[model samples]
Target: MDTITTLIERNDDFVENRFPSGLKLVPTLKTLIIGCVDPRVDAAHILGVQLGDAAIIRNVGGRVTPAAIEELVMLRKVTQAGGGDMGAGWDLIVLHHTQCGITRLGAEPALLATYFGVDQQELAGKAINDPHEAVTVDVAALKASSSLAGGFLVSGMVYDVETGRTEVVVAPSLLREETTVG
Candidate 1:
């Protein structure tokens, strides 16, 4: 009846073909991937995670949202139920890509304002919504809001579509050594 249903039905064969063995499924996701809709970047493949191991939130530009944080909060609760829980605090990865249509769209202020229903002047004053900055900012906000143990690890990265390489963008900090050298 809906586009999702239609698409799933049409592709059911493809999905069934992939899961022919009918493996058991479990929810062990302790990580969250916020990535763009670029077809070249597959979050699951890049993160080397199985189907039931991670919760991925993908948007036009992989921007964080209220909904994303809500999902994290719920997941954290589930993972904290017992010792050796697999779903506790989440590792957040904000993956952006080079030569991204979303980035291009982000660079254009007028277009950004037009889509967000605000004017350039308002946007410049932080009154208007910016889709690009919103994504990065949201990830940070989510990290701050999450109350999970170990204080929710958050990192932002840029993926080069051509080379299939990803690099982290770490801000200046006094503590915690950088994990990935960009």
Candidate 2:
């Protein structure tokens, strides 16, 4: 009845009855979603993505760090090399949520630095004053990456943890100025 044991039992049930057999490596939706590690913000549920629908990358604050870029590049390369119907291209969705824990770290610089193994100065780059602004910044970083090939659409979104709703902070077209998500 411990947590791990319960989780293992659930996994057994999943594999027995719910697991999708013979699914390919390529996601059915041909998309990638980068989101926060916050338990309240489940990217799959928020985006309505079923299993094998999209590749999800979760991290603290969901910042587009160097490691995230590397993973994205690898995903692109591998999927293209796989040579299938889903190999055409994939879109990117950067989802940040309101009331993220990173927004609170300003009051605990020491803890942040220790957790990330970096000095206080380095922690400034990870700050999240506003979820909307953070999503915009992360989307821009992903779009600017030369490693990610052209023709991929990137959208920035903010999920409201309180209301259980999500809104577009930056549309994929990137044609209009910022709009308040209401």
Candidate 3:
């Protein structure tokens, strides 16, 4: 069978045998995970979270660029539309991993700079070579973003591919004050 057909079969199985009916629009776990696009590192599988448990956003290197910040803004809008505010009682997890492919792109400063929406000289601050440092940077960025102004506990994590383990680099804590009411 083709990949799409096989995926359809999996969907059939999910609907018939494992679907959670009446799942709410908001994540039950009250968490949002941002992670890399690498197939080896899946936050859902690593965290053993079922569907509707958490909202996940994946992008290249999982770095918090201008685009990622905008995505968070959109998610806040989505939560508002659903009658739930993303600000309160939410955890934003910046998940990175070891031996990331993003490190390979460091030589292509132009591409990296373009992807991050920053000048080539500013690429040094991104810490693409180290997952730990990258997580720290991302957590700080999320915490300081007024676009996401409001209540959220932000944290950072690093997953080890060799051992299939995840380490919390930054523990969850309220990142900002509630600036606007829901």
Candidate 4:
């Protein structure tokens, strides 16, 4: 009848019918995705990934904050401690969507604070005026983190809610500027 009750009932069918036993901690695709909390932008559905394929981190704006980086580092540590192949390529995808709620909060600091329960100053870096630029900034932040090794691939993409299309804003190879031509 209620939301939780519905989910619990559904989960019963899931566990009984299709839930796999003893899945590995390592992602099958060896990737992690950071995306917005918008319901319209379902990362797994849009990306065509099933469960156990990747680790997903969702936030208000999909911004790569310090806390997100910490979680990533922990993931890496856990994977290594489990004797998983760390040298295998790990892709970090930062996915943002068009018409996100974060953009609406840019003009209303009071509303943003009320929603997130923080002061205005704390929300300074959380604004998303442009999804393209925001994705680039977030990807750069994740790539620059020392915890994430150089072998880790980081990319930025924007999912169009209107058209159900995803555009690559920043490729993993282009995360940094190329200063010279070979």
Q: Candidate 2 residues 59-123, lDDT tens each? A: 88876777788878677667767764322245678899999988877888887676545688976
Model 3 lDDT per residue over 109-130, tens place: 9999998888999988999999
- Provide the TM-score for each candidate, comma-separated: 0.58, 0.82, 0.96, 0.81
Clashes of each: 0, 0, 1, 0
Q: Any runs in candidate 3 off by more than 4 Å, and if so which? A: none
Superpose all Cα atoms of candidate 1 onto the true structure and report the RMSD in Å to 1 decimal.
7.5
Candidate rank order under TM-score: 3, 2, 4, 1
TM-score result, candidate 3: 0.96
User: Can you tell me which runs of candidate 1 are displaced by over 4 Å?
Assistant: 1-17, 20-26, 71-88, 106-138, 146-150, 171-182
Residue pairs with backbone overlap in model 3: 87-151
Candidate of highest TM-score: 3
Tens digit of per-residue lDDT, candidate 4, span 82-132: 766432377789999999888877778887766545588876554467888
lDDT of each: 0.57, 0.77, 0.90, 0.78
lDDT of 1 by residue, 60-156 (tens): 6665545555655565555445333322254666776666665455468886565434576654532124433444554555545534333346777
Please name the candidate that would achieve the greatest lDDT relative to the true structure: 3
Reference-based TM-score, model 2 = 0.82
